[model samples]
Target: MVSLRLRLGKAGRRWLLLFHRWAGIVAGLFFALWIGSGLVMLYVPFPTLTETERLARLTPIAWDQVAVAPDDALRAGGAVGLPAAFNLEMRGGEAVYRIAGRDGNRATVSARTGARLGPLTPEGALRLATEGLPDGRVEPVERDQWTVTARYDPLRPFLKVALGDPAGTELYVSQVTGEIALDTTQFERAWNWVGAVTHWIYLTPLRARPELWRTILLWLSGFAALGALSGLVVGIWRLRLRRRYAGGSVTPYRGIARWHHLFGLAGGIGLSTFIVSGWISMNPYRWFSSNAAPAEIRAAYAGAPPPLGLDAATLRGFAEPGTRGLRFVAIGGSWWIVTDGLAGTQGRRAADGLPLTVDAITSAAARAVPGGALRAVEPLAGFDTYWYPHGADPRPLPVLRLRFDDPAAIWLHVDPRDGAILQRLDLSGRINRWLFDGAHRLDLPGLTGSRRLHDAAQWILNLLAAGIAVTGLVAGWRRLRRTLSA
Candidate 1:
């Protein structure tokens, strides 16, 4: 029995060494690229149009020309019940109602003539793209490297317009919706090739097919996790603290192998966790559910379609000089108007045109989660465990957190200003937050509270990871040469 146990142990050690060595050879380069590119992404995130930026450029809604009432415009747009999304904004110097129905239909109705508008022509797209800037050129494109992701699917066949500005900015206007879908500057385009593009493997051809891209990421990250785990185990087994090596060193290796041993011992656990978390991000078994509020749940919360009972004069009174547009929202069985402008999004009572009171906002949040007893309502003035800002996407602060007593133990974060649902977290979602964001982004509550501390910790860990990869590459190269020579 003793002999058999010894044999099994020896065989296991041999297999572990072989697995770690060969896995390193296969995935070492990619690990290095991921770590390096992740650092680059820390500072220069992928270019995106933020809500504030989008609203800043939009001309204030032409309320004088808006002869059609909000209710009349909905009828003209052929909306049955409360539409999925009802946005009134200026498109190419015309105030239009963009109504998205729950039945997967969309319509753009002119506010002036109450006429349904069709898709934009190339000339119209160019005009929309260069609304505020000097137009340089316009070219129609189906897909490109920057606009290859599936999120831009609804706005396909974009018209790329170059603005002859100092920033070398290019805007992509949706031919279907005539909205400025995306904008990229020279600096953002140049850095993103090595940052987000390489980090996410977001090359146009691969990313165009989202499922294939996800599959590749799943398999590759899975293997990388395997490799990292094996290395971590091997590292711990070989590390000697009390009883040192023959040469009074903790590791039984020389030169590059010694560096690899030391770095692996230091950073292997973190590297393994990061890789595992990245694998989890692909959602291997579909264990995590989407956090979006369901259609029925949202409809229940809305209570009824927002009434456009207010007139043009009343609506015009709500606007300031830079007010971009106004949206009709249903909150707690009452209609409210949310104004988007230079001052940011603010809610007003549709009937009285008064600012939304705190009591009203809190009352509306109670109706959001039906059939669940309201356990607690916590107001978050800053980042917390579940509510935190991501890179380039700053989550609105001063949010109202509603906890429910449902089987899912659901939590909802509502915008205090507009009573909009910002995020929904259930049992599975909370688990995934730690598995993905906590492990991968180091976004723990303690670390996230202080930007300086988070940045410092990440930099130190990333440097150690980079060292491990560099030494692994050297060792792998040596092994390859020896195999060839042998």
Candidate 2:
């Protein structure tokens, strides 16, 4: 009886051990890739260039000094290697033109002086994306209601251009005098396509065709998750096998395998969380609402007073107490004040003094809520809590500027006008919103630290995933060869 029991136990242990080893070897590589890609995406900057950088590329020509026509400028500067669809924006002092091409090379030129500003050089852009704005960051200059002036290099000639949502607007500013020209047309349409690409992976028709890439990623991620789980099971099985067959003798390779199993187990959980959140974020119709009601409710809870149609100037005054370093204001039916708060701080607030049903008519001391409040409801639904600006720009919009508070905490939104509670959304909630919005943006302890950690993890995982795939193929090949030989 005892001998029979021992034999059965030994067989079970061998089976479990084989399962664990195969599972680990199979899933290790993919698990690493998903995590690595996620980390790379965390810090990658959006495609939009800073105002200063954009303007700097164009050698400033005197407003009175008009040298060439659009065609002449292109001819003088040499053939523009861009798509035919790119348009031109020329005024008294400045002339700017952009062209898109097949190779993802976009060129921006200063047409006034016929100077080759630069090809929004992909390499340079990528560098800027990796290494973000400098440390002693000044407040972003506000342009229009939805536009903010981002300075690339403060010491050099600053570029004061306006952007609305994530789209580029036609900003007419004096090239020589650096004065605001005519706010004729906002370049919302221009950036619409660009923003769409950045916001959703489905920007290009090719990308959207059968939603191939996304679908592939989904399946890949799913497989990766399965592989990881299987790996854990296999690893556990292997331990039992070792105990039964080897009589507690452990090989060095087995130890190494064991370590891999442990790390994979933990990393697997993190990767799974990210994947699930990311998938949920991609499906907005089923998850989020676009209209302003949910936003309003969230704002009200945050203590923001109702909106009142106040002119930009009045709104500025009402907001001055809470917002220092006021820059510019945009007054339409609703007023949006662009203020330069402390360095590295940026935010937005909306208010309506009248009742919910009444149209906001006055810019009086009505309560207002910051934009961040609307972002905090995402994570509870099992999504990551990073904020992603959905409509246009690929970058996460900063609707409220708060210093590095607890990343996990959601600060109270006060009405800039009345200091009332506007709304409250936690960091997790914001992360969830971002997950739906299609990006992972976590403001970690420090830029350097975060980037280093993310980059290192990515590098490790990608290599491992690639290695695993290769090894698995080799192993299968060897097994087939042996079987044939036998």
Candidate 3:
């Protein structure tokens, strides 16, 4: 038993040494890459044309040209599902009605006539594809995944149209929607390989198999975290401020070895936290954080329809020239026309067209939560404790805030459009947004307006950890070479 214990200790040390040695060699490159790429990502986001951007690029809709009303468009669409919302928007300067079903299906029909424009014509597709180019020259359209993946799933079977520009730009125009889904410049294409692709191991070949990539990353990060921890332990054990082994200095090891040991000791906690947070980000089941499901949101849209006599013509007259869309939401036997955008701004209900009384809206909102009772109903004039905008998730201004009596202490930000709850912040959501987001991204509420300072702080800490990664890589390489020679 004594012999077994001794052998076990030797084996444990051997394995731990090997594990740390190899994890550093492998994942150190990724660590450097993740930090560098993360810095780049902060500035240049993955290419996406937002709705506001799309609207800003287009001209105002011709009210005279819109002969077919939304009612006519609905009939023309031949929609099998119940219409939840009717939206009027310009696509390439042509007005179209986008009818959304409660099941998340959307059908687009021409506003000029009640005809269903199923897909873009070849000519139409080519025209949109070349819109971005200064000198219009184009190659023949082809059906392929040239500028598509799971990310562009909504806009699939794309028409790949290569431009004749010097940069070799290719635009992916959606065959279904007849819209420019993605625009890839030569610079964006080249830099992306170095930035996101190498950082994520997200080559088309590997990225296509999402599950495999996820599994590989999870295991890699796990071992890397373990390696950082082990390094911390080893660094502490080897630390002797007075005693000297190789060099007659405080640190036993000389040069790079000493640098590696000290940095590991200093940055081990951060390395572990960063790597563990990265792993947690890939947790789709959201075991670590609360995820708001669509089903849970549907709890608010329950019960019978609220009866309010309203129609498209009345809503149309209420719309601004730059209005993007309109939605007729019924709440508590009252109706409202939610006018979306008039030249890039927050949506608002029509003047004198109120949906439900404040009391009625609060009561209805309370009923949305299973056991919730209305606690306080206040008008959120500006950013408050629970209803501030974060990243791309926008908070519509002039919102109706409803506090509830549920154990979770749910707060719903109801859109003035039709008393529809735009945001729901329960205890779990607060924990996820405030606690998890604050720690993982270093986005504390105190630094809300001071983004520049936050970024500077982030860069400093990340650069320190990066120093550790660099030293570990160099040390691991030399050690591997030594082991091979022995």
Candidate 4:
């Protein structure tokens, strides 16, 4: 053991030190960028216009114009199979039924004429935009790369309308559904260029293709992880548990090199942890596959519909005060009425506005997917891998976790709160929770409780990581200066 230690300390470490030094010099700027951007991320997340914000901009419900019911609109639009979900919303002062099919197709049916809204012409798309935003001046619409990402999927070929507001709000109205799909303010756009865009290395040219973007980020972060690992090895080798250099300073290296060693020792594990976890997020091997049985959801999860004769007047009684819009979801073979409220989560069946029971729900969920058998109906009161809202998904819980028996290993998260299917996690998605979301965010159950606590821990860890990167930057600059002068 003594000889082994001596051999490593005397000769083995020198080569490692050399390699680490060169690698750090080459990749140090990116490390500093990742750390600095990561700190910014702890406070200011990637920009998004929340659903609440979008609803606030809408005109109130015009009950006088409502001629057709939600079910009538679906049939009018020639909806294929039972919709996995549907949003009963008003577009342009007219009631419109936006139906999302189980097969990922979407269409808007006019509640007034019961006519399916056809493909949007430039004039028609502009008319829709103007109706939604009366106060703001508009730019001509473009159906281009803006809404081509996964974030805006199922809501595309959008009519991009830039509002001349102080915040530079740009609203992307979905051409098919005639609904505002995404709203981005000026601050979100500007800050994101520095924060999420740079941090994730998400350039549009590269990120336009999902597979290509994931691959690029995976390879880049992979190399960065390599750089961090080598630095950790060298940092530990030069660490001073007890002994010091000639002047009795704790750090054997001088100046920036000393700071690099000091902070690297302090936060090397954190640096390595973040890089590797970030790489894992891309799912390079495609382990967890989304095994959602949509056909099963239509068969088992759907309830027998209320007669189409039920009209708009019936819905009037259900609307509460300050309600921007209403969405009716059919889950577990029952119709649940959902509307936005100040307190949030106002739910009851359409038949009698009665509170839902658990027994009725679980029975419907059991039929949602077939194969092996029923697993535990788990409640996600706390953050786990998949159910927690990492971004702008406002499907509030108390949510239900439905497990299945098939070899694909399916887990369906149903929202009992509003009878909405919140998330469908297959085998790959379950693993994704631990590997990507778990590692990248470090939201270990033991480490986190409330979101406030999670943010605090994330801040402390990220700050230490920033220190490591900054020290490396300083050292690399000095080293480069010496080399250039020599």
Candidate 5:
């Protein structure tokens, strides 16, 4: 042992130092690129328009005045110039008919008012569709009712909606007024095309497989993380370099190199963790569902009541105090509120009374989860724990939304009349939940920062990996050069 230690003294240290330096230098650029791209992805929101935004874009028509049958409306509008894939919708309140074309063209006409709202032009529709917006056309194939044939543009394809046969369409007749408050066929062919493009990233001219891209990037990131870990080990082995050059007298390049080493040593583990987690997130389905069985999912759903249909207007009244600027209302047997908060935080709420206890089948009035429960679960159930490694259970307690300090929380309200638990899911978890969720969501502001940091770490790690890969190359090159000189 003594002899081994002696042998490993100065010579071993020097070799280790060399290893660390070269490894970092080699992997630096690739790490930087990954970090930079990640940062951009973090902040860039997905291409989707909110319901209110959709409403604002089109004109409002009254609920009472739909004059023409859907088929008649299509006939009145003239020959169907666009392809088969189009969609239509009827907006409530004002009997407004909305026609959406495949490419994202949209036109709104008042059913009662008989006034034409502005049309979403083909160019505008194209832009929206390319960004993954929904576009389709609607026509009344029958009398008194409309048959909305939603089409997918062959130009841009999407996984959500198959091409040729568009996604499903909805029909609504005004309950108070006899008029068809909503019509789906008013938009032109150009509009439908644009909408189709907006709804799918794959439909874009430069289509790339999202899942495949995500998988590739994740694997690349994993490799980069490994490189980083190795570099860190190498860096630690060479601590003397920093001590030897601590004084200001050291050369400028040496000083910079020393600082780099210092940073890498301190930040390496953290960088590795982030990168690994990010890779895991990219393929959450694979990781999370690996351990989750259909049995388990069915079991979870079994205790729950059958889904219910909710009244959006009623839900709005209940959710108003907790949420503001309601964006979308998801109605089942219960209602969910998607809203912006008074603070910068986004909000979500369900009707008061969702029974959380596993055995209970009935819902109580919707109440916020108590503070103590939130405090307890926040650390465990937060995104940091729940979102990664796929199936790992970071068991969290049920907490109510209004009471939790989190900026966002899903509210599951159970209507007293029915046993359904209303589920309201926000893009972000509650404010407290944001700490974990924000890091994962590319929609949040920190997405860019987190991605950048991860990328930078990856680049540094990749350089280190390259160094390892080229170790033999380096040795060969030096030996060849020496032979040439001799």
Candidate 6:
């Protein structure tokens, strides 16, 4: 039995070593790229237009010129029912109502003429893109690296206009809707080649095909994770801690090999965790639920839409001193006009045009989870485990959190500022949050609480990972050359 056990152990170790070595040779470059690009991504995230930035860029609503009411615009736009989202904003110097129906139908109606609007021409798109800027050039693009993702498909065929500013900013204006879909500065574009582009494998050709990209990422990361696990096992098995190796050294290998072992021991677990979490980010096999509030949940929260007796005059009255735009939304079976202003987002009871209090928002949140018992409604004055801030994506604070006692254990984070469902985290969502966000982003208590600490810890761990990858790459290359020679 002892002889058999010894033979089996030797065979298992040999197979493990062979697998780790060949896998390293195959995926060393990918590991190196992931580690290096992750460092760059620490500072430079992918480009996104935040709500604050969007509000600031928008030309304030020309309310007086808005002759068509919300109801009138909905009718003229051929909307079947109450719109899922209805907002009035200035589009190419015209007051337009962007109405999105529950059934995924979207239409733009001219507030001035009550006429259905069509997609913007190149000139109109350029005009909208470079409203107050000194334009240098305008070029139409079907797709580019920055705007290549599927999220921008609905707003395809953008007009890229370079603003002759100090920042060398470029704006991608959606020809479909005349909206500034994305903006990239010279610095962002230059660094993103090494940062987000490399990190996400976000080349336009591959990413344009969503399924292909996802499949590739899953395969790559999955293999990389296996390699990491094998390396970790070999690292532990080879490490002689108490009984030490020759010359009192814990590691037998010298120079780069020695360093690889050491660094692997230090960072192998973390690297494995990160790679696995990154794979989870793709939501393979649909193990996690979407964070977005479902349409039914949103409808239940909004309740039956009361007749929005809003006319041009009433909407104009809803505008405050620096109100940029007005959104007609539903809350607690009633309608409310939400104003995006220079001060911030504010909501008013549409029936009386009175300011909404906290109680009104809380009451609406209670109905968000259909058929579930409302357990508790707590106020999140700051960021929490599942509601922490994300880079370039702002999470509103002072939110009202509603916990439901259901099988799914739903938790809704409501933005009291405008009565919007900011996030919906259920059981799978919370678990995914930890698996993806917590493990991948290191969004733990200490790390995220302090920027300096987070950066320092990331730098250390990434450097360790880099050391392991670099040494493995070198060793793998030499091994390949030797094998070929043999």
* Tens digits of lDDT, candidate 2, 1-486: 999999998887676666645554555454434444443344443334443333333332233333334344434444333222233433223544433332333344564566666422223322222223232111223233222222212112223333332332333332222322222223433343333333344333434344465575566555545554555455444444335545463322344344454444444444444445555544433344332224343333333222334332343343323232222112223323333322222334435323221112112112223333222211122112232222123332222222123343543332232222223445544555545332233323332234466456545544544444444445545555787799
Residue 445 lDDT, candidate 2, scale 0-100: 30
Candidate structures ordered by lDDT, highest first: 6, 1, 4, 3, 2, 5
Measured with C-alpha atoms, the lDDT of residue 37 in candidate 4 is 74
lDDT of 2 at 307: 34
Per-residue lDDT of candidate 6, residues 1-486 (tens digit): 999999999999999999999999999999999988988998999988777878888878877679987888888888886678888888867888888778766688899999998877777766777767765578999988998877777677788889888888888887666778788899999899999999999999999899999999999999988999999999999999899988999999997888889999999988888888888898889889999999888987888876787778867888888777889888888889999976888899989978877788778777778778778888989887777776666688898888998889999888887889888999999998889888888888877778888889888888888989999999999899999999
Deviation in angstroms for 37 in model 1?
0.8
* Cα-based lDDT for every prediction: 0.85, 0.37, 0.65, 0.71, 0.36, 0.86
Better of 1 and 2 by TM-score: 1
On TM-score, who's better, 4 or 6? 6
- Tell me the lDDT of model 5 at 381: 29
Per-residue lDDT of candidate 3, residues 163-221 (tens digit): 76888766677677676666666776767666666666666666666688788887876
TM-score versus the correct structure, for each prediction: 0.95, 0.39, 0.81, 0.83, 0.40, 0.96
Evaluate residue 107 in candidate 2 and report its C-alpha lDDT on the 0 to 100 scale.
45
Q: Tell me, by lDDT, which candidate is best.
A: 6
- Candidate 4 local lDDT, 1-486, one digit each (tens): 999999987776787777778778887788778766765665566655576767766666666767788778878767786676666666877777778877788888877788898866555656666544555544433333344467567776777676666678777777777777777778777776677777887777776777888887878788888888988888887776678667777667877778888888888888888888887776668665653446656567776665434577888777776665677767665677778654475666778888666666788777777665667788777656465555434446677887888777777777776766666788777777677666677767755446687777777777878888777877878888999999
Q: Per-residue alpha-carbon lDDT of model 5 for 349-445, expressed as tens digits?
A: 3445342232222222222332212221221222332232111122223322211233433333232222223333333323323332333332244
Q: Which stretches of candidate 1 lie over 4 Å from their true place?
A: 132-135, 358-364
**lDDT for model 6:** 0.86
Could you tell me the TM-score of candidate 1? 0.95
Q: What are the RMSDs of all candidates, in order? A: 2.0, 15.3, 4.3, 4.0, 14.5, 1.6
Q: After superposition, how far is residue 230 of candidate 4 from its true place, in Å?
A: 1.5
Error of 4 at 358 (Å): 1.9
lDDT of 1 by residue, 1-486 (tens): 999999999999999999999999999998999998888888889988888778866888988777777888889999988877777789868998888777767788998899988877887876777766755688898899988977777677889889888888988887777788889999899889889899899998999898899999999999999999999999889989899989788889899998998999889988898889989998887898778777766776677745777655677777766778787888777788888888778888888888887678667666667678778988898777888887797899899888889888888888878888778888999999999999999999788878788888788888888888999999999999999999
